[model samples]
Target: MRLFSTSARLLFNNAETKQMRAQLDETLKLFKEKVSKIKSDTSVTTDKYKNIAVDLGNGNTTELKQISTIALRGNNINIVAFDPKQVKRMQTALIQKLGVSATLSPHNTQTLLVPVQTMTGERRAQQDQLMKKLYEQLRNDARDRNSISSIRQKYLQPVRKRMQKKEGESKPELKKESEAIEKLVREYQDKLTDLYKKQ
Candidate 1:
């Protein structure tokens, strides 16, 4: 069953795949009966099962129910083992039974495959609003930068230039005042950038 779950794509061709799915649909009626043998009536198995068969003519099947979560695309399969330890067990079983190697996908993302048409209109609207806000923030940041630059040029830069031009006795005092004006500009720039990051 593990081998079938892993390599249903490679093992079964187009015709077999279709036959297998049809057989699974037929067997779904007997799911309650089959599952009863493995799990007693006391244990609750409320979870929905997705079962796929590898063979239809032979009546040999791969069951996914009670073991792992399975998502099947045309030839692609995604399995999430309920027990992490079962992963190694499945790999070993596949290798020993079929003599074919299996590669497990790395778990970097927690994305799960779901049915189509699950998205709501509200969710779409929220995404659209978020993008709009982001673009507005970027535009405001640019405008604020220009305004800050203009303000520095208009009020602060001229005073700094005058202070810098003074090359006589009070040159040290003038330089100190000029440095303070530059510091204020830098602080304002930092504050604006911080606000941009928040947005």
Candidate 2:
């Protein structure tokens, strides 16, 4: 004699699987959003330069765009500060952050002239390292948020409780359900790994 009729078992399995998949889909959506944010933050372009934080020398920091207008010239980027007093400080900040020297434009005292340099092999390697670090952080965060143990506690525990099963009892169907959840977890983990490699 079976504990549940075939139809009853099917309905239970379907409901539990649907619930688990919905959770997984929500997690995947959040993971993609984080990946998008990382890409936006790490982009190497004029917009990124404009967003770089500059120390204001009064124990405060502000973005370059807050005080200056950015313009691109042939082989150079011109950062013209709104305040003449901010020009020197802005130049120092740019030099430190960009690892390149900058000069005050002779034509405009408030303008800092920064020469554009191509990404060298060393710089490319450094960027790769940064991307690796960011990806690792994202993976760790995802794991913390959706670990197998936590999922079992949140989802499987309820099913076990409703079945009137003792915590120590090893039910075959529940075991199979756990394995299925493990497979789902692995699928999402592989997706994250693939995304990082493409970055």
Candidate 3:
């Protein structure tokens, strides 16, 4: 009997993407058979296998027993004869296979998300700290901008008006300057709007 199925082409969708899958199947078969023999000999205990508990959201948890057979959703945890140390070795060998499986089928989303979730969580705490720091920086920047705007309105404009009066400039020059400033402001606002829309 064939130890591993040769339906890799069908599983992966593209008929050409079978090389990695074939290698994966061969490796898995060897690993599984070896583990099964060890278990049968009473030399290895089930407890030797590592249990990686994953949060399934809504207060549910899934224990990943074997590295090769990654479970998708609902009642995911299953028992396998492999030990934790061997499980790690299997993980490295099957990583590319896992990636290919995800790319071929949208149904693998939940399964793929599990490994990704694990990887992301390794740095999630650090990312949260960085995010808080960024938020504080932005808040302080906005406050400084508001302070500058208040100074311009409360102090700078009145001083400029007094200087203009002392210089004896008529309404015509003031009207031209005001119109130019308004046009520039409108142009800048339109540009900002366009940029926002693109984003």
Candidate 4:
């Protein structure tokens, strides 16, 4: 029983050691690959970085010339440059690496002007639309006034007959009501005229 227990412990220790060694080997291999690349880069004497210009699909060029710092970690390179060009290039490279197909291009002034002209035309159309709406409102108001006057005339017929029959009827009250209605109708007509003149 003692021998069996000792053998079991040894087997467990061996397996643990093997797992740790495998992990160490993998880590060392990665480290060596990174070091090899760094050594090559150091020998290459990379150029003193200047402006980076990236042409965008929108026909715009972005340039970045100023650099602040550069850092490398393993296989990754970090460049800190405020130049727009550098940023664009790096972004493009990264996208390409990731298998993105979209490419940046330049923007054209003529293309931009096309949209501007279209917007101006749209604005003019809107203005014309507003004017037409105003004219319609004026016409509707005038029509409404005419219709009201017609209704008032129908309703006042009986009242006018009764007032005529009354010998004491002052007639001034009926005259005043008629004058008020006439004034309102005149105002509506004037509004219609103003709307027409505006065009």
> What's the C-alpha lDDT at position 117 in model 4?
19
lDDT per model, in order? 0.43, 0.68, 0.36, 0.40
Candidate 2 wrong stretches, greater than 4 Å: 9-15, 26-43, 47-68, 71-76, 80-102, 107-110, 114-123, 130-143, 147-172
Candidate 3 residue runs with Cα over 4 Å from true position: 1-166
Best by TM-score: 2
Which parts of model 4 are misplaced by more than 4 Å? 1-130, 141-172
* C-alpha lDDT (0 to 100) for residue 101 of candidate 4: 32
Model 3: pairs clashing at backbone N, Cα or C within 3 Å = none
Better of 3 and 4 by lDDT: 4
Against the hidden reference, what TM-scores do the models get? 0.26, 0.52, 0.26, 0.25
Structure candidate 1, residue pairs in collision: none
Q: For model 4, how does the per-residue alpha-carbon lDDT over 1-199 read when each residue is reduced to its tens digit?
A: 1222324433224554454335434433433354344434333212222234444557765432333233332332334445444444545533444333322223411110000012245555564565555445433433443232343344345446745874343456455444544454455446445544544
Per-residue CA lDDT of model 1 for 120-144, tens digit only, reads: 5765455445544543443233344
Q: Pick the candidate with the highest lDDT.
A: 2
**Candidate 1: regions farther than 4 A off:** 1-146, 164-169
How close to the true structure is residue 32 of candidate 4, measured as C-alpha lDDT?
Answer: 39
